[model samples]
Target chain A: MAGLEDLYREIILDHYRSPRNRGELPTPPAQRVEGFNPLCGDEVVLFVDLHDGTVADIKVSGQGCSISQSSGSMMTAAVKGKSVAEARALIRRFKGLMSIHEQALGGEADQLDEDGADGAGADDPDVKLGDLEALQGVVKFPVRIKCATLSWNTLTQALDEAPA
Target chain B: MTAVEAGRKAATPLDVARVQADFPILARRVHGQRLVYLDSAASSQKPRAVLDAMARFYETSNANIHRGTYQLAVESTEAYEAARRAVARFVGAPDPRGLVFTKNVTEAINLVAASWGGANLKAGDAVVLTEVEHHANLVPWLMLKDKLGIELRFVPMGEDYTLDLTHLDRLLDGAKLMAFTAMSNVLGTLTPIRRITDAAHAAGALVLVDGAQLVPHVPTDIAALDVDFFGFTGHKMCGPTGIGAMWARPELLEAMPPFLGGGEMIRDVRLDGFTTAEVPTKFEAGTMPFAEAVGLHAAVEYLGALGMDAVREHEVSLTAYALRALKERHGDDITIYGPSEPAMRGGALSFTYKGIHPHDVSQVLDQKGICVRAGHHCAKPLLRRLGVGATTRASFYVYNDESDVDALVEGLSDADDLFSL
Candidate 1:
């Protein structure tokens, strides 16, 4: 249970039980992207409303374990009403948090490899994670790292699809 | 002896403590706790005997089977063939010559679909399957459907998680083949194979039984069941990986084309074209799984000594205990998805605990050293039908005992406590 405590922090479970910005947005007004952890069937559907270089509204709707769903909820809370550039920076920083320990262990985090070396910036002082920092515990359990990052990756894809 | 007599002979209960000692892995500690492995439906842990047999094969008779005339090669070939005979006998196949060694059950099913189905089936021909089938049983037929335009029909699962055969004849109508599982990997539903085979035969259809989950758990007599083809894997039967088998009828094996084209399967290789080898060799194209066959032979011998009936009896009792314990402890909080009758199902108990996601439940359980499988269990369509994205499955085998089930019940409480809203 000592290891379990690190993986499921109190803040993380709160987000899972009561996910923030949870629902679907109409596709025409919002760009949607879905990320799947095929190993566990954990899915994350992101709907981002990017207007005038700002994420005017964002919602996450999917089903997954506490780590994935809570990470998604915390992500929506952090990125909503933020600039597109700010959101992308948060995504990189969050992924950095998830992949830092994985890189140290020399684990095969193929998903993290495509981010172009942003994983080393986990401790970047410029980026403040706020509630999103709760998910930093997920790196301890390597398999759940993908669950923690599923929403961030989907958010990245959603932002790419949205009008800049 | 008859199947019923075999069942009577299995009245001698197995010594579970002695059985656990045979598998070395069960003794190891995980997270400072004893390992309570309940995922045998996914893949079983091998015993010391199986391991020793494989090592012995490599040490003594490590050579290319059926290729060299050297002493080692001759011994290797004999050992491999003997393994095939033992595995075939375990399933009650009349002739060992009909058994073809495959990589795993997936490859075995694929071999049948590509070889037998390819040679016989045409566009619009229906291949009836069941809703409870694993992806191994489903994907191959789906691939054939995509390639040859063959129609696929499914026998629906009843509310009790058993196969609904109310319209079996209707689904098997005009069907060229009937493929289904003997026991579901996820639900542990023991299908009425003889009934299904009879219906399929009456409707002039050949039957293929996916025994990946069944052959390892119960008394399986392919001759008694009278199915055209049977596919199973070695890993699920306390044997090593990289080895499985497909047992087909002699006429069907003789008629079907070779699955993989390479050395060891040709009768005569000419400048222009080549003639195929005989029945079993015709399908076994490349190098045989020599060491794995030896391992499988030892595995079957081990299981034979334990007696499959005793194995089934142990599982049924353990499953009954688990079912009662899980429900009694958790009540409405735990929803186990399978047949309530232990006699009706295998040891796989797929469940959703306290509305918590299966991955979370499994993660919490893993900390307690309980190895349970979470997620779709490779039966996505079946999970969709059950209206759940995933489930935490705790399957029992000969190595598992009442204490393992108790650990699982206690671990679920721990998960419930951690996720209590």
Candidate 2:
């Protein structure tokens, strides 16, 4: 049986307990979107502030299970202050990490290893997933995948509808 | 004893052991312990009779009805129509033609909302529903309101969880339809259906009763209650899943348009237009669940043999015993919802332990080989009204005995210890 340690990773729990940038952003230059998982009553509201074609700020407020809340917390922290292009790239990378295809990246594993402990090497040939790689464990539990991706999906929607 | 003497004698109580024998699944073990099922309100355990009926249908008489032209077709048609008669008789409908088979009660309610509600309700037309309605009953009407620009109203429940008729009267004005549950699945409050229906009819509004919880536990005669429409499911009444019935007045069904259009529901097809079939068949589109209908028919026979009055009595006794036992054992440690009078409720109890979440209680019960349901139970609005996020519900059926109730109380006590504040 997979223990709570795998599910409630210390970093995830820390983020859930004290989520970063948790609030609403003003609507003038920011776009807001809501996401809901009907199965377990998890809901998330994502607000994005765009400044000069970059994500100046990202904030989230919601009530949900620990996995969803922590995932939202991690998402906001990962994309904050990044350019629109960078944020979109991070989303794609996060999707790749959560996808079942990650196991096929074996040949590129050594290149990823040289990216340093933070997993932030842009020069590495391998996919450097950064902090979002921690969510790979969620795929084992099929039901929790929705919880982990709900906020990211909401953020995608918010960014899509955001004024250019 | 003479036959008259035997007939006059008081009926024997429901034999839990004998009843348990009819259910094949009950003989098995779950989690290395004997299964103690206490979640019948969620969905009932199917019996051998229902299973065999379904299997027999598939084995012998497997053909499309109302569209085929062979010996197997005739037999299949007979069996399917017989099941419709069985359901109609079981619910005391005046005619079998009034019963429309759907996937389940949820779909039945949706059919009425889409068909009858769409044709009748207009902009500013009001719909009065109770706070205790299942999402099946609530959402369809809300969808109708959103589509038609109608106003929706709610009848509030008292602190005891019973519908307040005084408030209902006030909300009835300008209401074109009143939809409610005969018995709440979560709270187990048996709303006074006859009174509410009569009042709605007097106000010139039609009433739809969601009988998913009530039909399994008690005998329902649509003629006696004079309800405009009643919805019930098969799986909740010891039948196979994927089949249910909606009983509406013949005229009401005749007046409503077909919900889903397809082969069975059409009289003739043309490139230009097609005429619809009669009531019942008009609503049942596509290839029907013939085997499931047979299973539901057998379930009706099983309940009839047991006698609904006896079943209701047994539930009353069990619920009363449970209420007293839980109250005596826990007192301030628990908060029981719904009517305190057992006779006023159905075969379930919804309660909250003072300091434990329902999920925690369910886990403790699961350890003891007892299965109960925890969560909002698909009635989020009612749960919100009760001022709780969720509840621990233990529902009873014919197979349940006092021992099951004792086990539940013991499990809760254990949960209290394990999850102390």
Candidate 3:
């Protein structure tokens, strides 16, 4: 029996109960992006605002199973008020951590020929993905990894397509 | 042997002792009590017979089929072909040549969509599919539509979850193909296949029936129904996993090009080009799952011995009892989707408790050792039409009886009590 404590840690439940950046920002400046976990029918709409070169605001709203919803809530809290470059670095680090291929993050940074030259690597050095490290346990359960990464993936999409 | 003799000779109707013995998993306690499996629609419990068939094949005659001349190779090829024959007979197809084995029903539909559909359907051609189709059927055609510029149309369902065939005739105009489910996995409505097929044929359209939900419970005759294509999975029909069959008319299969090109599906390879093999062999690309095929054959024989008619009767009666019992217990608080008449539906039932989320319901049911699927159930469009994000589904199978239904009712009551709504 997988303990509820192991699968649904206290931090996860807390995020689900009282999500951070849980509502939509105003229009004109923010872009709305929707992501779905087709496996468990988890959906999240992320509203991201870009001010100059920084992510000025981010809000997430959706309905899903606890893992997905909490992951979304945590994602918003983690990336809010960061610069675009910093947010991208955080996403890469988070993905690498979730996929259990930490080396791939280093490989991806090297492969980004354009970004590689600009010291994007040095600017956002491989900082330990703190609370997000909890999701590293999801790799053992292949099916649940999607639940953990759905919001992060959505965040990436919102950031990529965000109006410059 | 006559159907009556077959029924008499078959094993008892999945009694507690028989069920416990056949499914090794049932002996284990999940959340404390014995596991009450009600998610057969997702996948069925494997019997010892099917399991042993695979093991026996692998232990003795494991070889790549149809390529080698050795004794083991010959035996493996024979076993695989015998499984094809069993599948053909199981679905009442005239020739085994018409059946093509794939990984599962999803791959089967994709084979048709990519090969036959891609070849024949043109820019203005329309594909008529039902709203209740699983993503397996829906996505493949959508992919074809995007690639080939074909129009994808949907046949609407009534509030009762039955297909609205009155508008089907109108929608059939300029339709090239009609793909639909014989029974919905979620709502459990049994679509009128005969009428739908006949009307589609009259409209000069090909019909493909998704029989993943239908083949397990009911006796199906492809020739009698006059459907052009039928797809079903092995695991759902008491067979081993990783095998499924698609039955097409021999002529239609001959007309269509091969779905996949590889070792088995080739006849002669030259430096310039290669020639394709026969009807079924042309469709089977790589090395087939020989052991899985043998297990599927054993599964078909097992179902035949039990008799599909009796199985259907047992399920219909059980579904009726379940509907009545759940409705009695929950009253107006429960919203059961699909037809009220069990005879008009299959064994699955998707429902929503007024105040409870389906995930919460499923979690509570899990505590009671009752396993039911909770989600959109791979039918997002249909769920959206039903105005719900998700629902909890409890599906029944041959092993299920009245007691299982009682357990489900008890579990739901427990859920309601815990939620206090």
Candidate 4:
């Protein structure tokens, strides 16, 4: 029951009201990606610019529930000015926070990407999700877990599509 | 009972506590809170009678009909046919043979589109539908338009969410069929079925009344509405799923070709040719839904015992209560999406709170064991026309009382408190 109280904190609502990096980056260099959750009609579009294998800038625009839209704001703020690898690391941590099991939901949970790396959970002692941990309560509301992760998942796709 | 509970019991006309007792699920909880179900517009919770009827059928007489000569088979066949007659009578259609059982309302609509539209419609023919139709009613006709080159005209909607029929005469001109829902599932707007039926008939077109939302809540008479087709499903009416019916005139059914072809739907079959069975059987195809039909029959009896007039009267008062409570409590923060008057709507209430997304509202409501529908509700075009992306709908039913509406109000207030700046 205490977990339910933490699910919608004042910070999350503040971000939902005044979102950070809440627009698209202007230029051809930015890689754009769109993600939609047809279940609730939540949509998020992410724009990113990769400079020297790092995220030079990021912006997001979309309409959705408080959780998803606020998550978009937090995600843009979390990964901006970080290395592309660091952004990927943040995504991995974010998903781990939102994941139901210790392993990822799909059968390929154990399969590491080309980096030959460990499938580490976001609770890693060295790397923390920081303020994004506020969203850890999302796992409590199974139906709304997708709303909190739509932006991060869409941002991951934007990273993949970004130019090296 | 709690004080709030006693207050609601006094406010509501029906004995909602007794009604709730008939549904075992109402005693259960969602998210560790007492369940407050408000999605009956989607489907009603089954009463014990419907459940017992189904269990009794499966326990005693679960057998294929029309073929097996054993006692169980004979009993099953009798029960199935009796269910059809019960359903037909419940809707005030005189002849049971005039009813064709389909899997659900979507299938029933598709059956009409495929069978009647296939046979009667040509490239030049047109079908008139409303802007507020559910996908079940809209998609089949759109598919028909794709298959054949028929023109599909739509009746636009007013700001209040009812159909704007200023040019309905022109829209119905040269139309072979006029299909519409008796009630709008999204906005809870009750369409003027009698007026629309008269207009469609005057325009020389047949009509289909999608009663999926209307039939369960009100006393419907196909003869009084004077529509050619009455489509509805059983699941939403407190019966089991997998059974629905379309009531049409016997002569009209005789004229339309069979929708699905299978063993039960044929009088005789050969490699060379086959003869289709009579009206209902010709449309049913394969083995019918025997047990679900029994449950639906029990549902008819349950509703009849409650008296459809009283059932409707209770909801009318409940809707009025909800509308006033939500408005008086939240004011501009809450925006209901249907007619301001309770007379012009069913129990389904689609609305939004400030700018908080409906999904979030539904999620919060679910925490309080308040179940609601959030999204376009399979009526994307209507939602788009309403200038909103999605809405949270808290619909009422026979089991709902003033407490349920109070629960909804409390939940919405919670939504605003948690999400507001």
Interface RMSD of each: 1.9, 4.9, 3.4, 1.7
Enumerate the candidates' DockQ scores in order: 0.69, 0.11, 0.26, 0.51
Per TM-score, the best of the predicted structures is 1
**Across residues B282-360, which tens digit of lDDT does each residue of candidate 4 receive?**
8888998989999999999999888777788899999999999999999999888999899889999999998889988
Candidate 3 lDDT, B1-421, residue by residue in tens: 9886576446355344564477667778886887889999999998788888888998999999998999999999999998999889999987789999999999999999998998899898999999999999999999988899999889998877898887888899879899999999889999889999999999999999999999998888888888999999999998988999899988888889888888888889999999889888899989888888999998998888777877887888899999999999989989999899988999999999855668767877876789999999999999999988889999988778788899999888876765542
Question: TM-score for all predictions?
Answer: 0.97, 0.80, 0.84, 0.90
Residue B145 in model 3: shift from native, Å? Answer: 1.2
The DockQ ranking, best first, is: 1, 4, 3, 2
- Candidate 1 residue-pair clash tally: 0
Candidate 4 chain B has its poorest 10 consecutive residues by lDDT at B4-13
User: What's the distance in Å from true for residue A16, model 1?
Assistant: 1.1
**lDDT for residue A15 in candidate 2, whole number 0-100:** 74
RMSD value for candidate 2: 6.3
Clashing pairs in 4: none
Task: Report the lDDT tens digits of candidate 2 across residue range A1-164.
Answer: 44334555667757766778899999866788999766545579988998998889988997665577778988888888888877766765665454443234333234223322124423233445566666777765555676777787787777778765
DockQ of 4: 0.51
True contacts kept of 2: 0.00
- Mark the regions of model 1 whose C-alpha exceeds 4 Å error after superposition: A100-113, A117-123, B1-3, B6-10
Task: Report lDDT (Cα) of residue B309, candidate 2.
Answer: 74
Once superposed on the true structure, which residue ranges of model 4 sit more than 4 Å away at CA? Answer: A1-3, A27-32, A50-54, A83-86, A101-128, A156-164, B1-13
